[model samples]
Target: MDRALGLACSLQFLGLAGAMIPLPCASHAHVWAGECCPVFWGDGSPCGAATGRGRCQGVAGPGAPAGSDFRARWPSYFFRRLCACRGNYGGADCGECRHGWQGGSCQLRHVVLRRELASMSPGQRLAFVRSLDLAKRTLSRRYAIYASVNATPGAPLAFRRATVYNVAAYLHYLGSKTVGTPRGPNYAHRGPSFLTWHRMLNVHLEQEIRNITGDPSFFVANWAWQGRAACDVCTQQLFGASRPDGRLYPGSVFSSWRSYCTNDGPFTGNMSVICPLGNEMPITRLNGWNWDIPRSVFRGFPSWQDYYACLNLSQYDTPPYDANSRFSFRCALEGFIDPLSPADWGIHMHNAVHVLCGGTLLFSHQAANDPLFTSLHANVDKIFEYWRRRNPRSRYPRGQVPIGHGANDYLAGFIPVYTNEELFQHSVHFGYDYEYT
Candidate 1:
């Protein structure tokens, strides 16, 4: 029934806007594009690539107790007042709210709003990660309400437990400002591709895990490159294609070349394949951008799943943490607790935010500090949840998905690792919804 309605809507939309229009076509409000685009302005999306509209679902609230007023000010003051439109979907205020849509408050029920979770209080959010650490103790205990994830443990549920452990370690690392490689001054040096960020982050996680657990076995060993090798060596080796000079292969680790940084300014790497000029440019992935799941994965897939899962992995014992090693990786199979097949990447993204950032919404902060420091770690958790859920039944060739499940089942077997009750217990405080005028 929903499919039929969707089809009807698609047909109606097509009829109203010309059945077949070229990419980058400007419509009544938005500029349609086949290529990915990055969002500018002070919109609070992390790497705001053109994955979809900002979402409003997921956990909400303040990260700090008194910080609510400061946190609320952004949405209340700025978001409510929509920005003016700019060139080719570019705008000073990001596309304008259509007629009848109130701009004073960002709350346009029909439009997409920034859906974020808080992670202010590590002491509080850490419990969710701790549960996975102590999974053996809670295996039999039944809570009044279980996140759909608790139901399906998957065959050899220990693998799931292990996966959770891996996730926990990574989350703990992100939450703590522990020692790791720092983001450099040159944004291009960091290579702004989505996978680049993940790789850098994983490297940091691996180092932190080793520091804490004293086990190198917890790390996944992969080849490391320096200088020019950083750009295309992995892609050329993994896939038969070479990155055009100046076009950084953002998806080098991940099989797909679809980058969250694809649309965010000129990137340096191999660009002959994408650019006609073949200019050797430095890669750039700006703030406020994102990447959606690979399109091919969803074209021939299943139902809508509400639950989410988080994967955990441990590093293999080796030369401890390699300051020079460019790559270190591992894989984990994810199991969904629910049967719902995800229809859109947004669904997985929405739920993941809660798991990662939900608990830190309303913590007590000192002054005009940013909640994002807390919120960013939460976003990391949310992405991990999304990755685990998307792993079921589907095979993501490039990145890690545990051994047992098929690629398509990746999104299926995933269940929300954290529950509402657990979140409440771990939360420093809760966030109030933004009101629109």
Candidate 2:
């Protein structure tokens, strides 16, 4: 997988690469080193003071007022000190080189080429599956995903260690569900931040896997779902097929996997309760099957025309950008208003595929529990990158927007926070490119 993509590190776009400092290692990638060190961000990770990659340092508040939601202030809800890394090293745990660079010295630039699953060779496919299973079993070194009992600033919170794969799933749930808080549509959706936040998630997941496997070129492959009625990635060799009973294939790796946040109910109607990051329920997927589905969520995959229409919209975002924005590329791409006809209210692209997949992929808060959720999102990020390349839009809206969707607001559920603007640039800024489609 190491292909030697010889692109050197340069600051052609000063604004996008400003935070990427040229310390002995690098900057912009910080970590939270609580009580673990020899290992990092997760199990068997690196970048510790002992390893000369990073050290713990004290931090200031996130500048939120008293009585603000716990998540609104992010890591402030978790820690006052942070593991600041040196050199080109960066990530949630400072265990890897920044996006573009690679190697123990951290000076090489390797813009990884992320591809579709079908393009992977048989050996590559098995390696990817094995790596995913390893990630699911390996617990993050000292990190824990917390579940809040209520929305109040000082409510009781529960914390538990999760596997690296589960960490990604819980972060997605965190981005979508606000514990007991019924604030707008959580952090990563329905606005300009939609593209940036999910892109960051994909990037973070990719890095963690790389660190776990010691495979510098490890990238999360996409499952391009367009022009196909069946879930192409659903096979024992890939993500394993499911039985009618809702459990995954008996002997498959995913069959042993369980979902997060299965216990929490919808809090929009009553913000008093929060979703638990649950493992009791299995990931149930019935692609294109409506035989016994209690209700009809959309069926079949999106067509090529729908994908093109969404990408063709020129506006970054219009006024009232939270799911109601019209004629906006971000809105259309997020699958709110129809991209072909702005007046139509049908689900189109992103949202359409979620419901089309059915079961675990249907619910926004718990969708990441399904393994291909990452594949689904890898495609989503590729589409956004494609749109940005063709349409050339603003990083974010200038006017006041929703709480976590603002340009300057730190993206929820990340340490060494990134703003909507920080990640709004090209994927190459984050050290990866897509071979999507």
TM-score of 2: 0.79
| Shift of residue 311 alpha carbon in model 1, Å | 8.1
Please give the lDDT score at residue 405 for candidate 2. Answer: 77
Tens digit of per-residue lDDT, candidate 2, span 110-185: 8999888989998998888888889888976534555444343223444445678877886776677542334345
- The pairs that clash in candidate 2 are 24-87, 25-87, 25-88, 26-87, 26-88, 42-141, 261-277, 261-278, 264-275
Which lDDT values do the candidates have, in the order given? 0.21, 0.66
lDDT value, candidate 1, whole model: 0.21
Clashes of each: 78, 9
What is the number of residue pairs that collide in model 1? 78
List where candidate 1 sits over 4 angstroms from the true fold: 1-199, 202-340, 343-437
For model 2, what is the C-alpha lDDT against the true structure? 0.66
Segments of candidate 2 deviating more than 4 angstroms:
1-65, 78-87, 92-95, 148-155, 178-183, 265-279, 289-299
TM-score versus the correct structure, for each prediction: 0.17, 0.79
